[model samples]
Target: MSTPTAGQLALADRIAHGGPAPVAAISHVAAAAYTDPARWAAEKTALFDRLPQVIAPSALLPRPNTAVPHDGFGKPLLITRDADGRAHVFMNVCRHRGTRLVEGMEAQYAPRLVCPYHAWSYALDGKLVGLPRADSFPGLDKTSYGLVELPSRETSGLIWFAFATDADFTAASAVGPDFDAFGLGGLHLFRRHTHDVAANWKLIMDAFLESYHVQRLHAGTIGPFFKDGVTAADKIGPHQRSAVGRVAELAALPPGDWPALRAAVTFAYQLFPATVIVVSPDYVNLMVLMPRGHDRVLVEDFMLIPEAPATEKARDHWQHSWDLLDTGVFGGEDFRAATLGQQGLESGAIEWLTLGTLESGVRHFHEEIESRLNTG
Candidate 1:
C-alpha cells in the first residue's frame, strides 16, 4: 500500500485530538436549484460540459486493445485503449453516414471497431483502417473519415474526458496525487453496477459531501462504524475531500504509522460537478454520476479491490464487502435518502433547504456551482 499523504496525516491528527470539523454559517439554497429546468440547462452547459469529467477508473480498460461504449453523458462515446496503451475517447459514431458504432456497456478486447451498419472498421486510435468495396465510392479519403474524438487525459489511474475541446483540466488533475497515495491506479476492478435514481445529480452528491446524515440515514448499516459529526474536510480547488472514521481507534495508533491511520479512516472525495470516490479500508468505490434530467441521474458505481481474488475464500470476503456497500449501504441508505429528499422538495412544501454547520461541505459545493454558472 502507498503511504498516506500529508493531508491524510493532518486529518488523522485533527481527529485524534478531537478537533472540531470545519464549520460554515447556516446557509440556504433555493429549492428550485434541484427542480428548475432552466437552472439544470445552465448547469449542464457550464459545469458538466465545460469541465473535465471522470470517465472511469484506469482499471476499467486494463490492457491494450480494450474498448468500452459509454453513454452516461447522453453522448454516445467509445473509450478505447490502443495497442500502445494510450486511452482515447471517441464520439462512438462511424464516419460513414454517422451511424452508431458500439452497442453495449461491457468492455471488449478488439483491435478494430467495425460499424454494424456498413462494416467500416476503425483502429483503436480512431483511425479509419479498412472498408469494404473501395470501388463503391469515388474520392473517399480514409484519412479524413475517422472517429470523432474528445479531449481526454489518463493520469493518476483515472481517465478524464472533456466535452468541450478547450476545457481546463487543472482542477481535475489536482486530485491525482491523492488518488495515487491510495493506490487506486493498480487496484483490481471487482464489480461494476449502474444505478438509475429519480433525483437531481446534486442531491446525490450532497449525500456524500457531509457526515451529518451518516449516523441517522445509515444507522441500520455502516453508520455505527463512524463517529457522529466527527469529520475533517478540505477543498482541492473545487473538489472536496472529507474523512470520517473510528477516531478513538485511530488516536490509539503509534505515531508515523501511516497504514494504520488509513485503515482507521474512510476518505470520501467529491470530484467537483459529479464524481465521488470513497476509499474504504480494503477497497475503493468510484462513482461517476451522469445527470439524465432535472429529476434523474445515472450512477456508474465500480468496486475496486487490492487484487484479483486468487482463491474461493478471498473471493467470498471481497464479495461480502461488495454486497455490504453496493446493496446495503449505498443503495439502501444514501441513494434512498436522495430520492426521498427530492420527493419532498418537489412537493413545494419548502422554498429553501437549510444547511447546518456540519454540512458546510454541501454549502461549499453549491457555492462553487453558483460561481461557475454565474460567471459563464
Candidate 2:
C-alpha cells in the first residue's frame, strides 16, 4: 500500500478523521495548505470575514437573557434579548462618532446600548433610541444609525457565527456527520478554558490529528493505553470518524462496551477547520481551536455529559478524564518545541513538515485545508 489509491486515500483520510496517514503501510502525498501567508490571510478574510453560519442568531437563546460575548468578525460581540425578547447582536461599540458601544460582558444588561462617552443610547436591537444631545444631529435617522450587527447566533446548543462573505453559509450541513455522530446537539457547555498557544493555528490543528506524539509526548500519562494505530476510520461526508483505543482498555472488554469504551472508542468526528467531539462512555468533549493569526491560537475546551453520568462520582471521574486529557495535551515540552518549529518556519524551515509514512490523521487534515483553499 505504498501509494494508497485515491479512493483508499480518501477513505483513510476520512476514517482517521483526517489524521495523518496510519501505520498500515498505506501511503499518499498530502498537500500542505497553510505554508503561504497570503492564502492564510485569504482564508481568514474570505471565510471568517462575514457572517458566521454556525454562530446562532440572537433569537435562539432563552428570553430575559443578555447577549453573551461571542466571536464575530474577530471582535467580542454582545447580543441582547430585549423586553420584547428579540435577540440582537451589536458591536460592543457605539455607532455615534466611533465610540465603543458596550464596554464589558453583560454589564448591567442595559435596556439599550448606551455610549458612556457621551450618553448616546441605542436599543437592544441596535436602534438609536436616545441621546443627551438630541439636537446635535437634527437630520440623522435613528433607524440608520443603529449599532453594527454581525451575522451570528446559537444553533444546536453551540455558539456559531459567520464573518466570511464568501462562505457557503451551510456550516451546519458542512459539518459532515449530523449532530448525532458527534453525540452533541443536546450537550450544553460544561467547561471552557482558552489557551493562547504560540503556534500557527494550522500547526495546532495538525498536531491534533495524529497519535504519533502519544508515544513520546504523552508516554507517562495516556500514552500507554492508546497505541500508535487507528482501529477504524469512516467519513460520512465532510465529517470524518475514527475509532481508536488502547490494549489496556480493550483487553477482555465485553462487546457491549463499544459505544462508550470497549477497549476502544470513537475518537471523534472532526468538523474540518476547527471542531472536534471526542466521546467516551460517560461524557463527551468538544475541542474548538480558533486561529487568531499565524502565531496566536485559541483552544476552547468543553466537556459535557450525556445524562449527568449516573452519579457525582462518575461525573467527577469524567472530569478527571478531561483533566488527564488536558494535562497530557498541554503537558510536556511539546508546546515550546512547537514554538521553535514556528520560529523555524520564518527561518526558512524545510519547505514542508514531512507527513512521514504513518501520521495519516495529520495528512487528512492538511489535505482538507488544501481543499478549502483551492477548491473552485
Candidate 3:
C-alpha cells in the first residue's frame, strides 16, 4: 500500500471519533448571495479573475507539443506542453487582430499554432514565429507580438491558471503538497460528465462541502456508507478537506488494524474558488464549477482512475460507478435541490436562510468569498 500523508493521519483520528467540532453556530446568510446580479459580477472579478482556477487535468496534454483549448469561463485559453517538457498557458488570440486561435480541447501535435484569421503563427512557447506579409507592415517588430502568457503550474496532476499574472498565490500554498497521497499523477481520466445546473455556482458547491445531508438526501446511495452529520473538516488556507467516516466497516476492525482506516472513509477537498475533489477508495471524482450567470453554472465532472480499464469487466465496473455517482448523488440529490432552492429564493419568499452547526463548512466558504470580495 502507499504511504499515507498528514491529512490521511488526521482523518483517521476523526473517523475513530464521531466527528469534528462545529466551527460556528447556526447563522443567516442573505438571499442576495444567490440572486444578486451585481454581486455575481463582483464575485467573478474578485474570485475568478484574481485567483488561480483549476482548468483541466495535466494528463490532457500528455506529450510534448500537445495543446488543449478551453473557453469554459468566457475567454479562450490555451494550455500546452512544449518540446522541452514544460507546461504553458496563453490567451488563445492572435496578437495582430485579437481573433480566437484554438477551437476546442482536442489534442493536437503541431509544434506551432497558425491563426486562421491572418495566417500569423506562434510557437508552442508563445513566441511569434511566422507572420505573413512581414514587410507590408513597416517597423512592426515580431518580438513584441507574442501571445499573452498567463501564470500556470502543474501540480498534483492538475493544471491551474491564475488571472492575476503576478500574485502571491502558489499551488503549494493554496492546496498544500499532501494531495500526492491520492496518487493523482498516476491516474488517467476514465470519463467526463458535464451538467448545466440551474443555480448559482456557490449553491452547487455548498451541496458538496458538507455530509450533513447524506443521511436524508443520499440515503439510497452514498449515505449508508457514512455516519450521519459526522465529518472531519480542516481548512488549509482557502482550500479545505472534509472526510466522512464509514461507521460499521470501521468499527468492525480491531484496534490493531486501525491503519487500514484509510480505505473505510471518503475524503473531499474544496480547492478554493471553484473545484471540488472527492477521493473514494476506488477512484477520484473532480468537479469544476463555472458560473455562467447569477443563477446558472456549468459543472464538469471528471472521473479519474488508476488507468483506463483494459478489460470488459473493469470497464463495466467504472461505468456503473460513474452512473451511480452522477445520477444518484450529484444530479439527483444535489443539483435537484439547488435548482429548487434557486426557484424559491428568486420568488422573494425569504430574505435570508440559516445554516446549522453541521453546516459549518458552508458558512466558512461564504465567509471566505465575502472576505476576498471586500479586500480585493
Candidate of highest TM-score: 1
The segments of candidate 3 whose C-alpha lies over 4 angstroms from its true place after superposition are 18-20, 133-140, 171-174, 227-229, 247-259
Clashing pairs in 3: none
lDDT of 2 by residue, 189-284 (tens): 445555566777666655656656767876777666665445555554545655565434444444333343422444556656666666654566
The number of residue pairs in model 1 that clash at the backbone is: 0
lDDT for each residue of candidate 3 in 256-305, tens digit (9 for 90 to 100): 44346656777898888999999887798988888899999988888898
Pairs clashing within candidate 1: none
- Candidate 2 global lDDT: 0.57
Q: What's the residue-level lDDT of 54 in candidate 1?
A: 95
lDDT to native, each model: 0.89, 0.57, 0.82
User: Residue 331 CA error for candidate 1 (Å)?
Assistant: 1.3
RMSD of 2: 7.0
Q: Residue 356's C-alpha lDDT in candidate 3?
A: 87
Alpha carbon deviation, residue 224, candidate 3 (Å) = 2.5
TM-score of each: 0.96, 0.71, 0.91
